[model samples]
Target: MQALRDISGRAGTLLTAMVFVLLLTAFPATAADAGYKAKPEPSSGDFDARKVIVDHVLDSYYWHLFDIADRSYSIHLPVILIYEGRFYVFLSSRFDHGKADYKGFAVAKEGSRKGRAIRVLADGRTPDPDAATIYDFSITRNVLSIFIASGLLCLLFIKVGKSYRDADIYATPKGLPLFFEPLITFVRDQIAILAIGPEKYHRFMPYLLTAFFFIFFNNLLGLLPIFPGGSNVTGNISVTFVLAMFTFFTAHWYANKTYWKHMFNMPGVPLFLKFPIPILPVIEIAGAFIKPFTLMIRLFANMTAGHMVILSLTSLIFVLGSVSVFLGYSISPITVLFLVFINFLKILVSFLQAYIFTLFSAFFFGMAVPKDSH
Candidate 1:
């Protein structure tokens, strides 16, 4: 059975690789036929690398696949807005790539309103800064990526769950199960059990697993330079904040009297320090909030910084190319090599960040659960 499973896995991997190569070969032709035109070379002094890099990394209302000349191939996401007690829904493309207005709303392109949906004035001359108050519920690229990753997670675990039930208890995982079981085990044994303690680890396994896989998968996906992949979902501060909040709530909710007492009233500290100053307890309480805050900022900063550096390197090629096509071509190989190295580093960092976040969460959980009753 082991031999057969290995053979099957190899066959499946080869087949997948072949399909991927075929897609790579065919995508250009299909894109050309679909009206994707070659993008124009950047003119020297006119090329703003900063703008290019920012647009690529930032969240957008549409998923830009590619461009040919002036023609762009993009997926227009839905735009939803709540204004003046009325709800408006439309396609993002209706904004004409941020050049035109849609109904009473238009994409903000300049000034303080950049990258936002603002209401056009009654006379339709300028954006109404006041009345443009909008509750944008639009599904931007980052939001779409989040949904996609979530759906993929559901499909993945559901299949794994089914396999667990159908396969013999002693049998090894064959396909997706084979690929993921080790990761699941690592999270369970190394992270949860070791950090959270075996007595309480089982209860937090589901949260730890969910967080580990979600962050890891999104980080991997963000490294891809293609549609449905490059949207910086995990790098977005809001997303990180929410994830951190989960840990914050879970830790505090499970915290025992000892946890609070240690935080609010230290046991061994001098009485004067505890009563008159109470500095240590105040600091400890602040630390409780700081733990999750650090978690949020740490993940957000690392992932965002990685994306910026990689994009900056790619932009260098273009920047040089703008000066002289030959110079750009000459540096292309070197730039690509650096880019590849960074990508490999990013992959390692992705796993490391996931592990760190999960381990830290477990540590916090353990801290909340007292080792012994006083």
Candidate 2:
């Protein structure tokens, strides 16, 4: 038992750390403004719900903490850019919340590059066509949120691991480990072992646990309405793509000869199907790629859709208020009720998505390894 606990602790810690490092290093940062500019109380009599939702959903250069008294408060992250082979590093605040140009680069307010840093013309208003190849590596909001989430996981497990390492062999688990141990076990037993088979489950537990908790944690964090929380890490297709690719590579890398044989040449199949058109084999090969693609799309779409629904509901208040203040006030209760229900549902979804992703990953891994290997 002691050895098992020790091994699990080290493995979890290592896997968590690796994820943390990967999140930090994987993507080049992008640009956006500080605080999300809240639409003023509809004084214009027109509310753009689409713009509001897009701003909230998309990644930004700074962390928007909150808005106050028509002023936006945000934590500006560092911006790294390479333009014309020259490296530039500075805080995102230099953009002045997308108001001013800094060092010949400004946040593009129009065109295809809207909301992104771009090289400016001499007048400093138009994008410089000559410097079109600027490479933006700034630390955007989603990237920073990923950093925070990964760091928290690392800290949480590190503390839990230390507790286990320092305690007596027979001591009862307590604190964070008390909460996490069962979860770790659930992934190992209920998901990994059940799907991948007991004999081969041990090797995949670290990855399964990592994927499960990473998705689960990010989902919960994205639901928060405050600083360091609202960034849509999981909703970003890029993040999901990377995650799916990891599973894709892992599955194919460890696939047995039988798995490939079944993919290319299934047993008992009619010769007509295999010989001339090769339709079945082509479909089987496509399924291998499709499996991971579905994983990516499932996570991205669910999280993104949840945020959009919630934002649209919230926007409804302003939309109604634009006509009459009383209408907005009247709708608040109903909107709030719906919001609460959806949020609760989303909480359930957060866990469910994580579980489903991990579950399917285990299934794929199991499919890759022939049953006879066990």
Candidate 3:
């Protein structure tokens, strides 16, 4: 329409065209249940053949791969689990999976084929399944990936800060940070500025940044159906809950004296109302905690739902097979096609979830650190 042409400008027109093109090319996939699915049976020999991947591999249906699983320029493995199932599942997020996709954690399972020892564990020599895998869960790929990412982020910030400190020296976003332009801008302008206001964004940027990339990277890697590092990053509600708790604490950490004063001692209150109905203060306090709690659940559920939808669709391929391969084969492409689409959407959602989480966290932090008046 003329309205759309005027609205998007030149870039918008191109983007709109791309959207139409992609959508036109896009195949329709049946709507199915959402979240990762683990199979109770075996699958093809290749790791990709499984339903999903991560710190542990579990059988599930849905999801797909474009470049590779748990890849970050040959950095981390796909975090996942294999639960003796007949399907493979994954999530799409901002992952930095490595090209050298090796395996880890094939602990004696009915479906896994054992390989040579990678390292010695407390139990003794253990098979790596991938043969090249080392250290086992000693580093715990997910945790290690997080730790490494944290370190890398810190180093990057330090470099940026140092550049600022030494005005003569010029250093640009060299590595991972380089890839993040719109992401950082979106976080800063839309997320931090809009949510927390400019004055207070810096105080909370640490937690927000940590959570943003952590979730983003982990989510992307999780999309692949493999092992030792996959979408399980957020699927493990505990992980999300913990991240939420971090935001909870960050928000509460610098709660100004006036903020707490208002919480405990509201102005213009009646005597009797102040006693029981004063529960608003308690409720208000709980709301503070609940914010992040909801954040955790929201991200976890959304990401899981994306995975599960694909899993269910993929499961159709196998489930219908009893009738005939024609049914499964006929449906498989449809399922996979949609799975890929949703998988791609998941990457955006992963970034978005991280942004929303960070934005809200920043808002909470701004609430925590306040001026005497506002």
Which candidate comes out best when scored by lDDT? 2
**By lDDT: ranked, best first:** 2, 1, 3
Provide the TM-score for each candidate, comma-separated. 0.86, 0.84, 0.60
lDDT of candidates 1 onward, in order: 0.79, 0.80, 0.54
Model 1 error, position 42 (Å): 5.6
Per-residue lDDT tens digits of candidate 2, residues 64-127? 7666676777889899999878899999999888888899999987677778899998777888
Which portions of model 1 miss their true places by more than 4 Å? Answer: 1-45, 110-113, 122-125
Error of 3 at 186 (Å): 2.5
Candidate 2: where is the Cα deviation over 4 Å?
A: 1-36, 40-45, 110-112, 129-131, 267-278
State in Å the error of residue 211, model 1.
Answer: 0.6
Query: How many clashes in each candidate?
Result: 4, 2, 62
lDDT of 3: 0.54
RMSD of each: 4.5, 7.7, 11.1
Q: Which lDDT value does model 3 have at 318?
A: 61
Better of 1 and 2 by lDDT: 2
Instruction: Please provide, for model 3 over 330-352, each residue's C-alpha lDDT reduced to its tens digit, 9 standing for 90 to 100.
Output: 88777787766776676677667
Determine which window of 10 residues in candidate 2 has minimal summed lDDT. 26-35
